[model samples]
Target chain A: MGELALRKPSGTLVALVAHTLRLQLKSALIWGGVLGAYAAAMVASYLSFGDPQQMEQIMAAYPPELLEAFGITDMSTIEGYLAGQVFNLAPLALAFFPILALSAAIAGSEERGTIDVLLGNPVPRWQLVVGSFVATAVSLLLIVFIMGAMMYGTAVLADTELGFVASVEGVLNLWPISLFFGGLALLCSAVFHRRALAIAVPGLVLLAMYLADTLGRVSEDLEVYRDFSVFYYYAPEGSAITDGIDWASFFGITGLAILFALFAVLVFRRRDIYT
Target chain B: MCAVIYTEDLTKTYGKARGIRDVNLTVEEGEVFGFLGPNGAGKTTAIRVLMNFLRPTSGRAEVFGRDTVKHSVEIRSAVGNLPGEFALEDKMTGERLLKFFARLRGVKDLGYARELAGRLGADLTRPMRRLSRGNKQKIGLIQAMFHRPPLLILDEPTGGLDPLVQEEFLRIIGEVRGEGRTVFFSSHVLSEVERVCDRVGIIREGELVDVEPTDNLVNKSFRHVRLVFEKPVDPGPFRALNGVENLCAEGPELRFTLYDDLDRMVKLAAQHRLVNMEYERPSLEEIFLTYYGASEEEDRDG
Candidate 1:
């Protein structure tokens, strides 16, 4: 009993965050490998176009509105083509990984009856919320880095001239949008006891936002609705890949993620954990 | 003795369903308090509120003189808990889980955890999903005890355990009591509670019906009485006796329930040629039913 004297609750937050991050490493690699392979293959496929100008002429036959909807403004450069093909829609799908993982952090753990044992320790409820978000945020970054490396490594292997900085900007830009939804899922998990609601709320928002952004680009009437969607802030087009990282959108999306994470902590701190 | 756990009119309601209702309880230090209840009797609910896993709807609870909600982290630091419906990550082995929990509690040594595992015959190397319910229960016990916290709040700690393991666990609990530590655990099994607990609190239908010392609770209940006569005898005297209910009579055998009329019964039996007599105490479940079942009928009548 003397050996069990209480210690200061200092390192629990760090320990929990690190443990969650370590647990997620395997899934992070798998997600990174799967998504990265697709990006890498897209990079390698650029060489098969034979002539960029001729291919651009062939793509020009498609409807202008349709091409704009898909973000195919230019197919001549590998950066422009990969931006439209990979970066444009990849975040929409990739965001679900964080949503799924983070939702399970609270609501899912409760559903599985594991929350009691975990919370049986002296962990602060706020730490559980914040630590999960931080870990998943870090894992999301790892996935983004892996995707960027694969794209760059494939470009080097194929002798393509995709700027390393552009590739880095393109993948790094996905972090904020993915983490934004992960934060939303975290909030939902804290507010609601059902894991399905936690996953579905953010999942539906992701799809609606994607449609709002894409449809807004094609129609003036729906364009106003795009401002309400989170996708409006995620501009991973020529701006992220060709121009540079959009600092405003980056901060806006990340700031919203932090806001949602704060709400998650507040709600989780007050709510009863049903097991 | 100081009260290690105290609740004042604690209540928790879930919509229309009753969780716990104005429940008051006190668990003294260095005593093993058994929270005895059947399923859906609010034992788990009360324990969860104490752990701060669920907040009380009304009133308050305290652990070691600190508010359960306001000082949950501190309370948890001083307490080891095993939830009734316990679970562990399916992919993690018991050893890894213990190590992870140890880190969270800032415990550097795994020596006690390893000793508990060995004593319980728990295979720490196997993943949780691969273990049987009893094995998982063993791991749960080890984790709750490894920290050696001053207070242990275990919900159904002996659930799914074999007789041998349960015996070992009871032995450990006895040792904990010897060290002047407080233990509060919930269980539906009475024999184990009778074996290890100093006091017993019986809850029925979301209310604390009775709280008494273990010996007193058993002593106050009815007993099964049997009398064998020398030859065929009339059953009129036994059947007409007060406090004798559920009487059965054969040619040379008579059986009945005796409630607080042992002296009268012995005198009545002396009138007959008593060849053999047998009197057995009722089980805890029967004692519980005698209390709640009668009260339920009284409520219905009102």
Candidate 2:
């Protein structure tokens, strides 16, 4: 666990990304900047909702399905629109970064033959995997937490009456969803040992899940496909956009993560380190 | 003597390609075993398998009495490995990379890594990506030796270094061997192996053809001798010379494999016009080629 701590999930994640990002402090600033901009944009959209005439006009422009697809089902009021902006559009940015982050831990290491150098030590492969996963998970959790905090602040500033707890809940709802995507990406990295494949994996996963969700909502015959996408469990359909904390769903996603991570480790161990 | 590194008909395949096949090898404890082969002879593959980077297709490999595949963690804990090719991260400073590997190997300080790197003339400040091939090899060597593992597996470890650095690498090996650790290192270059290795294994394609002490293998093999005379004469009389293998005759020149004592041959040659006489050492490269047998995949079935 000492070496495991060194390869801790957050550290592993940071290690992966720092190198690819040239280990410059700029990438961190850049991610922070993006979240800040998203927060600002959500606040601007909510401000437009302060005008009843403009709010009604904006709501009529996009259909409920389109808004829901974007996780923006309500622009009827300021707080609702902020919820739409954070849970829907924001998770995409957070979900995929961690995959890139985690895959960098192994895919990049294996690619460069650095895995040989690192594994030449006494540390077990399981520790390396766990450390990498933990690093990725932590980085992702941090990114989502910052985004959630910013969005919650934006929701309150737009409508001063909005409850901080409700706003925070809406923001936090996206963590497990991001984890599920991160797990999916980890599974892909285990299967395909190349960085290109690892980089493209998260996108393909999200696309497949989106298609599954579309199929789930469209026709009666295709409803079974909804079970395939973890997004189905995270769909924002509550009154406060993310009413109470869904511990069961969050834990369910965590369970999925453990399963995916275990599968990835087992698969990784059985095969050769692909050059 | 106990075998520090041993293999019993070890086999490894990638898809349909032969990685290593039916390779029976043994490295005595504290002996420096040089794995000799041409490029793609599975030198790297075999080492990778022994290091647990790859699983064997069949058969077994053991390091210090531990199964390479099953007890990989234990094997790794006790082995230092240097791969043939590795791209260092451009972002990490050389100091950082060395420290990371040293720490991973359970070293509290980078003292040993820095010592080896300094002896090898590596620049710790520069990013590894910026280093020259020779310098990168220095880093690879440093990382593997930092832990002082009982068994060191190096694959093509000294390709880009100059003679001076090559000498330094040899010195490191000597120091390691003096401590009673076994070194299993590979090189396509024969002279290097001839100079340092106590025991050497010749691998061609994916097969292990021969394994013997350096002096014994060299003494047992034939040298191609070429002699010149003032006039043409039948050289067939010398064909039955003791220890000779391949024999050939040409006008005014006699060429044959010389396995017999060179002193007798020099006396025999002193009788001739002796326009010119020279013997060329049979290269280990040529000896390695004997095992390639065309393509790697084709020889597996045979």
Question: lDDT tens string, model 2, B199-259?
Answer: 8887886889788898876676567898888887666566656665666778898888776
| Off by more than 4 A, model 2 | A1-29, A48-53, A61-65, A105-108, A149-167, A194-202, A214-227, A239-244, B221-261, B264-282, B289-302
Instruction: State every prediction's TM-score relative to the real structure.
Output: 0.93, 0.83
Model 1 chain A: worst 10 consecutive residues (lDDT sum): A1-10
Q: How many backbone clashes does candidate 2 have?
A: 4
TM-score of chain A of each: 0.96, 0.80
Task: Tell me the TM-score of model 2.
Answer: 0.83
**Share of native interface contacts present in candidate 2:** 0.47
lDDT of 1 by residue, A1-275 (tens): 32344544679999999989988999999999989999999988888886999778978899999988877788999888988889888998899888999999999999999999999999999999999999999999999999999999999998889999999998998999999999999999999999999999999999989999899989999989889877777774454886678888999999999999999999999989898
Question: For all the predictions, what are the DockQ values?
Answer: 0.50, 0.31
Collision pairs in model 1: none
Query: How many residue pairs clash in each candidate at the backbone level?
Result: 0, 4
lDDT, candidates in the order shown: 0.90, 0.73
TM-score of 1: 0.93
